[model samples]
Target: MKRLASVVALAVVVLFGTMAARALRIATPAATTGTAIAIPAIDTAAAALHLAAAVRFPTVSLASGGPIDTAAFLGLHQYLQAAFPRVHAALTREVVAGLSLVYTWKGSDSTLAPVVLMGHVDVVPIPEPNLRDWEHAPFSGDTAGGYVWGRGAIDDKSTVIAVLEAVEGLLRAGHTPKRTIYLTFGHDEEVGGRYGARVSSTSSWREGSSRHSSSTKGGSWGHA
Candidate 1:
């Protein structure tokens, strides 16, 4: 019986070892094709500063019955308008649910379906007890040692600011998409997106316009 158990264990190990080796053998793609467009140099200093400034807002989203910071959300809206003047000038802005924002950039061709870019600005709050665990103040928007520190720095604000920056830059360059573009910024995501994403979707449906696809805050692309 002892010899049989030893043989079974050895056989299991060899099978798993073979399986691991096979899994590790990933083949390179046969053919990859893409245009090599030169990426323009970004002003690192300005980019970092802007991200840091966005981090300063403590737009905490809480579950129903929990506290929500409306002031921070409003402040972020004001900051976005000031930062991306061209976006505000070109895109038609509307507030949904009193706090959520939607911006539509009209396209040259009405036949093409619009594209929606969705991002949330609200973040989960850092509990008072966990404050000591943070390297910097939760709302300080600290930029140090090649890092931006704050609550919404990575959760949702980064995507929100990035989309605005891209749109503003494109507008400045006089670049217009063939299809209409919609920018939707949700105010609540950390808890539940009921008042944010869900409302935006319902609003779009009511408008009788279909969106081809949506680029979500956390890098998800979905067909609508």
Candidate 2:
């Protein structure tokens, strides 16, 4: 009887596995035009070019609140608007410090607390030996060698680009997450929030946030 019961259990497990494989095979791209109208993302080649152009916009912040690279910051902002036209056209974009950009995606339930994902756009001043230490120009967003090289290439800008890309891709695929995703890009986090005196300011941040899932990090992004 025991042997017979074990065989029955194994057979049931195999049946479930077969059903799962069949289900996966059945999942196909739905025939629809909903995604096609919402998002037309920039091509991968153009995306790489946008990253390169973004990295070239020198946005190193200062502590004394003196003159800043306003032109550079503004240019990057404009680049974002141009790069993710789907996002710019659909999501409401709010700019702070001429660089800090916040994009909010309303969720199915607006009553639930919003999830904020934080990143910084500004990079630290290039060290004196920065150019010598770098294989490519520090400010140059070189897309050569399968890499986007720059001071902030792998850092916050990547996060910014990623979130925008995800939204663009989702809107294109007509998919939406259950909860809201808030993107906060700080402009002066590299300078201890003292960039540009008191005229413009960067807010203080922590490694984690309580606004989102306890298991999931708020995604405090920092990379070389």
Candidate 3:
């Protein structure tokens, strides 16, 4: 029985190792010495700074005729365009309703269906005034006590920045994906997705997804 258990454990390890080896290895951005630079000058502190500035936009996307502040949301879009010039210049961007920001990076092969990486830009509304029970004000986007505080920071901005970081870093590194990559950031979520990115509303976000052979793959918020 002891010998049998040892054999089983060894077999399991070998099988798992083989399977993992077959998995595709994602290439990281090339930087300085040709080493994988995950992000171009990945400024952890600066990323937080950018998030803080974005939080200040107050992009609250509510339901239709539901007090959705289009102005604030648009402002955020402008800021991103201004901040990431390389991203804007390099990738082909499609904007729907001045809210949804969808960027498409043409892959080495257009034969493959596109993946829709989605998230929302508009955050939920904050109370008009403090309840006096909270320790930090929402939308502060502050790195307080080493914790990132904000409305969209955790919910989605993290993903947004991540995608941008990966792509931006990759671009700076001069790497490209074989399959198409589409980035979709919706405008509304808290209230409803009536205007949120459903992967069907925008043509670019879907990337001809309506086709029978073409399918869409995307990652959502809240994943490490």
Q: What TM-scores do the predictions have?
A: 0.78, 0.66, 0.71
lDDT (10s digit) by residue, model 2, range 1-224: 99999999999999999999999889676664422345546477766777778788897876655667778888888888887787777666777555577676666765555566666678778878556988888897888788899978876677667667777777767666455666667778766644322212333221223365211123544321
Weakest 10 consecutive residues, lDDT, candidate 3?
211-220
Candidates in descending lDDT order: 1, 3, 2
Model 3: pairs clashing at backbone N, Cα or C within 3 Å: none
TM-score result, candidate 2? 0.66
lDDT for each residue of candidate 3 in 126-215, tens digit (9 for 90 to 100): 666753544666767677887677777766676677677667767877777766777777776566666554446545645554322111
> Which candidate comes out best when scored by TM-score?
1
Candidate 1 lDDT tens digits, 179-218:
6888888887776777876655556523435665555557
Evaluate residue 140 in candidate 2 and report its C-alpha lDDT on the 0 to 100 scale: 79
User: After aligning candidate 1 to the native by TM-score, how far in Å is the CA of 112 from where it should be?
Assistant: 0.5
Query: Residue 37's C-alpha lDDT in candidate 3?
Result: 33
TM-score of 1: 0.78
Give the range of the ten consecutive residues with the poorest summed lDDT in model 2. 198-207
Compared with the true structure, all predictions reach lDDT values of 0.79, 0.67, 0.68
Compute the lDDT of residue 13 as modeled in candidate 3. 100
